[model samples]
Target: MKRMIFFSAVLGIGAVSACGGGGGSSAQPIAIDFAPLGIPNTDQEHVSYKVTDKLIVTYSDGSKKEFPLSYEVLLQSGDQMGSYKWGQLLDVNAQPMSNIAYTKGEISWNPDANSLIKTSDGKYFIITHFEEPPGMLYASELDPNTLKVKSITPIDFSSVGGTIINCAGSQTPWNTHLGGEEDYDLNSIYSVSAGGKNPAYVQCTKDSNGYFTGNDVNGKSNYFCGYVGGVQRYLKDLNIDPSNGYLGDKFNLYNYGYIVEVAYTNGKWDVAKHYITGKYTPEMAVVMPDRKTLYMSDDGDYKGLYKLVLNQPQNGFNKNWCGTLYAAKVKQLSDQNGGTFDVSWIELGKACDSEVKAIIDKKPLLTDIFDVEDPSACPTDQGFKLITEDRINECLRLKVGQYRSSKFASDDEVKKAAAFLETRKYAAYLGASIEFRKGEGLAYDPDNNVLYYAITEIGGSMADGKGDINLPNNMCGAVYRLVLDQNYNAYKMEGIVIGKPINRDPNDPDYQKYGQKWACHPDYVANPDNLKYIGYNTLLIGEDTSYHINNMVWAYNVKTGKLTRIAWVPTGAEVTGVFAHGLVGNNYTMTLNIQHPFVDTFRNADGNPVNSTYNDQNKDKRKGILGIIKGIPAGLLKLTH
Candidate 1:
């Protein structure tokens, strides 16, 4: 299972404190060898803890600190969850209670609506804690009143023969949990029924080997073929060799960069049809207000946005996920040519059908892909080569739905494509001294309808220890917000502030008005006049203080977009990103994993899959859940509330 924790990019170097004391008084820092923690030490893995019975910490220095179970903590958590709660820290038979697994994990709450669903079945809200993508998923089902796990059930995703990496707790139209994965190989979505089994739901695919197919006629990439380490190179290296190539024949991986659904009745998974075909990859599935349509992001080569429309109704409560795919294209005005370019909005209705096809074959132009001023441009230097709409319509008319071209195109085609791509525009240009890590742990605020993402500062060479207060090339991260215009027509970094400067181009009209230049290296967001910089990572905003734990991007709300750090975790407990589980009572959840330099995913212009490879791998760390059950005590916060 390829765990997709994006936080490893935030590698902060701090003093290694000791694991102080034991379960009674507040334990001081003490020593703890990570090797024994059983956590995956890769940049993609993490170690999570629930403040239960006691606060347990195995420090890097080989000592242990167990904070005694505190009733006060439990009470506090209860207040936050809307009631007082308690549970048995011990297992059903009265054991030490240690069956927690860690991988790419998330923390979620069961809202009133979801709680009603669970209560009808005799279960209450559970602040699920588990390792994402790698470890066995386990949730602490605690009572909102007592703040305890009424029961301890493993959030299992083993059916598809894979692990759960980074997952988004999708609030289904039917009001269930659609836990997704960062597993590019075995990408499956699981559902947690109201009153179901331990896992509650099963894989969405019918069989273990989930079904996926790209809708273009050029075929797919190696990412789809399920090549072990091939995804990393196929994406970053940018060019795919069609024949006699080392990575494989071509980039068939695109064929597999699709979504799947978990079935509860039968232990199986059913893959969904492709939403957006060329030059894009889908991550974080958020259903639009319309309920039937889903807004997805491009974790692929295109680095854009998209939406998934359910062409067919979800089979009632049966959990069916068959839908039509549509890529997002934003409509923006271009100052250079006095033209309006749509960035990430999909052309709707029949108007899109023909254009979509032609864009697939004729290949879209790459003039300005990421110019902040030109919302439609990313970079004119390198962009995708999409086929035109006419050709796409022709293929559709012929009932041709697959791309059969060689994995890698011919040399002549490559040369022509490369030249055209070189002139492509960029949505946000990083230049030689700048770079932007792909955003991760993305979530939308229903209340505000704003999109949040984290950008890791992992790659790019660092200078000597001059600027390094602790380690060289430290992962000084940034979090960014994609504020949807009132019309929700597009999202931009305009008027967004990060660090010192407001992310505005001086030449643009809004630049001087905002009085900011140079956006953060990774991501940023603007709320009114005050702009807040979110490190490239997952984020959680609380009432008072903000938290920047390791890879976790936890922050406190300053009413609007302003942000401040309240808590931070250094290494071992690296948080990749954060997600707000609306079903889980809107309680926030963050994912953690090991720290590494190269942890990422990429897709070809044709929507092929790719991954990042790291040289020095951490050995001990694994994946697990990190739950922040606000307003509760420690002891009562047990397996069974």
Candidate 2:
């Protein structure tokens, strides 16, 4: 086993020289080394959670200490070890909440993001986010010593509408949980081109005459009605009927895609969505040390990288969600590796939550914001611009004068509403680069004044040899480091780590030698999704990829550029909820989850199907796991501050 070493200087410590020549001299710097786990490439190894790493700490006085790296399975999917079962749905009052029969069973087992928080009153809680159509959040009170779940209660979002597709999140500097909603539903609602209707949209928007109206086969009128269908389905899943015309009475498309914050105060939990962050499908939102600047990753192809700078910086973000949203326009500096770029901010207007929410209340459709025309019939002689957004090409002109409805007070109001409601389209209309593919997770390093952003894949518009981002296709993806200035604005981005692509043919010589058949090298990171900067020059990266047979969790030393495999998940399972909780009690701990095991399939080098050996207590392959790697020494994770 190859060992990884961490160095730290012993300050203000002097010792007599061994040669007895000098009276006193500064002691040598101490080094802490650890053995890393091996890569899992074989059948048996692919279906197991393996962590064979150990930490050895050496002192300048010739003394040494060693601690074995071990993980504890805190909660597994479907485990009824607490008041509420792991991943189980519960109402705000701790009562069981029902779901539709088809999705009820599946939503109870998918756990994505985990935020371990310590309150000012010396209480500890873990906030877990469930990724589903109508996403949910659950808070569990933990016994600080044993780290066991004492009680569990689901955080209600009924007041702030409802959150969907809750994915990766981060803990705020103000000691609150900030979660994300990956709202792909926006893609279906705003699709306007012919033959571009989503099947789910077709099924959801039946007219009053009991016929599908907003479908590609039929004339595409009322395409926004598809969003109503999604809300109706979510309500039905919650065992609530929408026969009372709840779709028209409530529910808005702009309400779902913002960052949600969950804070506990006065013995109650409060939830609020940051609408000022600009609505989009966010994978994760991470705040800089300044507590006002935020970087959010948009999780799909041809999406834009967003940044929000809160107006009232001293008051903090949670207190005031009002901010200015900006999109990144990149200039490719180099095409080598995964590519590097010079980043410039494109101001995408400014608005508060109240201002944007008032516009959403009017229920403005796509046509209300812009006059849409077919791509071929675009009137270039007029003021129409041909733009492609969400894979649909259309000619759009901002609605002004008497061209739009009487809902807006002025044309300025219409533009302000479009800035927040149709964020990606408006950014594109303003000439901002909206061509990033699979932007996943974000991590900030306060000491270094830099931010690390993860790109799961480098294909799609990113590699199309046009526009702002033009690079070679590397489906294995890469991680880019952005250099931040004093004001928390990023000026340059460089690829620090890039994955290696390999031949997936089972009969290939490389596949036979590596004992695996996958699209990416098993040793390097494939589709790096969730990231956690655990101080001491280390960043933990979790994989969410089908390209790699067995997904892995790696610890990369940013200073030394050393990548070490720390853990592995079962076949077809993604390593999610990768959080580094520093110095919980006497030990440093990290939380990670295995989500949706066996949901995908893998093949061996011999072209034989490989199945997972992971059998939870329920003997089901569809379950997930929420675990913690405990006993990490404080010496291995000393903060730079």
Candidate 3:
């Protein structure tokens, strides 16, 4: 009965009329016992050490302190892993150490704080990387009256080599730090810029795609690393063969998605590709206050949302490259299974002519197209794998709204509105399937232009509500927001509902004529009276290699739209357990990211703290992890909405 009214309002803990619904069998009374909104992480470092826990140290009594050991604590203790030579952080008794100054117990552990930005002189750097094997990208400096983490500066993924995997970046229009690159035969796009005035270590090239020949050098391509002031590099083209316009194209190497514009002012490092794509895994790349349009976020598997319209016009650092890519049309698909949720949209001119004719015929290889449901493998051993159709059309591209219909019509209905995109099926039911519920982070609030998403869990909640995992919890993950109907603000799609609509009286007997698509309740308690609950969103509940709720993003309020919460940095701290994420920076320091931590906190094998309890009977538990409250600021996030 509406899952017994969402388990009597999430096991009655977060109670509020137990959220309504389950009021029948003589109203099933007495069974209350609630009280869980904090405390239970038990803290002790979620047990034993190393493999993945991606760094987290947030305290102020929302309580959290866990460090699961990494790089085996600089090789199990006698610490000193330096050698940046000229960019600093030196040692072996040589000196030059304000970058990572330790000293109290330098042997055990304490290097868990993965990505946090704010440079340009406002200083707040904070990037970490080390699950061992030379994976270094340290750089700390915080304190602001006890925010702790005083000084650190490591930087060494083998001086920007291969196994550094992925690291979303952004802070340039000429300030430094760009970093980019992730898989696709060993991606590339680095430039820490150390101390500017021409700092070096560049990489990016492809006029002939031998995949850059295992890091070739003598032909001028050991992936460059030298030329910052002249801007001679900013790599990652992957394999672009979209019918050759040339810049290298092994059948467009699945267009390897977007973000390419390496500018370092007159001295060197001026690469290109700034933005151009067919969609799918464009990864992070942000630039809009008209820095000539570019706003990406597609960690593939059709998680949706994108942008890149600049073929001309320029601003900020000036580097424009051809453009015209826009994806995001699901129009409706929110079902929940009590059987009535709503929003079945999908037409954007037949989903951009079936994603530019599937990236212009062929080029799909992300481990062999579709089927990514891995609740821990073996439904016959996990499906929809990838090695490349450019990682299966960059995992089904999506940006949001209007799948088709609106060229201002007329002209006699423009060839039946382009042959009504051949009776659409919503990008083939989200590209043949995979919603094992895992679509992390994605925010765009410019003051309530509304677009906050974070699906962690939406099925288990009732042993009196606080962290209940009883089963039958399908409706997958939750935390949604899609409002845009201020009278259809230029029709990106109208009043996308989220609550308030259980009006039944069409002459009784359960009428239901398309007017009921959920919203009568899901914890959206009427505010401007249209269903709300956008605060610190959630959904990842318990076990799956160890408790979850990876990368999450949200920041809205363009004149009172409210919804803040963006402080993510997980993926088992870069062990790559998924939740990929995007949106980098430029224009004097920008931030909203996640990547790298290889381990420093996250436990289970009985050690507890995989965000409290979790499954596997507690797998070596060591508990302690849960902190929220740090959202709103970017000068109130770009003014007007």
> lDDT of each prediction vs. the true structure?
0.28, 0.67, 0.26
Q: List the residue pairs that clash in candidate 2.
A: none
lDDT of 1 at 195: 30
Against the true structure, candidate 1 reaches a TM-score of 0.42
The most accurate candidate by TM-score is 2
Scored against the true structure, residue 391 in model 1 reaches a CA lDDT of 8
For model 2, state the Cα shift of residue 310 in Å.
0.6
Model 3 residue 22 distance off true place after TM-score fit, in angstroms: 11
lDDT of 1 by residue, 1-641 (tens): 12222121111111222223344344443321111112122333322322223333443344555433222211111122222121112222222222122211122111100111233343433322222213223333545443344544433333222222333334345543433333333211111121331121122211122222111123423232222222322122233322111122222222233333322223222222221322222344555445555555433112344445555444333323434444334333331211123335333221122233222244222211111112133233433221111001000010011322232243333222221121111111111111122223344544455555433332231112211111123233333455665544344422121322232355754344422211221122211110112222213421100111122233424234434332222222333222222222222212222222123222211223322222124322222222333421122111100
Model 2 bad stretches (over 4 Å): 1-34, 56-65, 81-83, 90-107, 188-230, 233-247, 314-319, 504-509, 603-619, 634-641
Model 1 off-target regions past 4 Å? 1-119, 125-146, 150-169, 183-256, 260-281, 300-302, 311-319, 330-344, 347-437, 453-560, 580-628, 632-641
When summed lDDT is taken over every stretch of 10 residues in candidate 1, the lowest stretch is 390-399
RMSD each, Å = 18.2, 7.0, 24.7
- Measured by lDDT, the strongest candidate is 2
Report backbone clashes per prediction: 189, 0, 99
TM-score of each: 0.42, 0.85, 0.24
Indicate whether candidate 1 or candidate 3 has the larger TM-score. 1
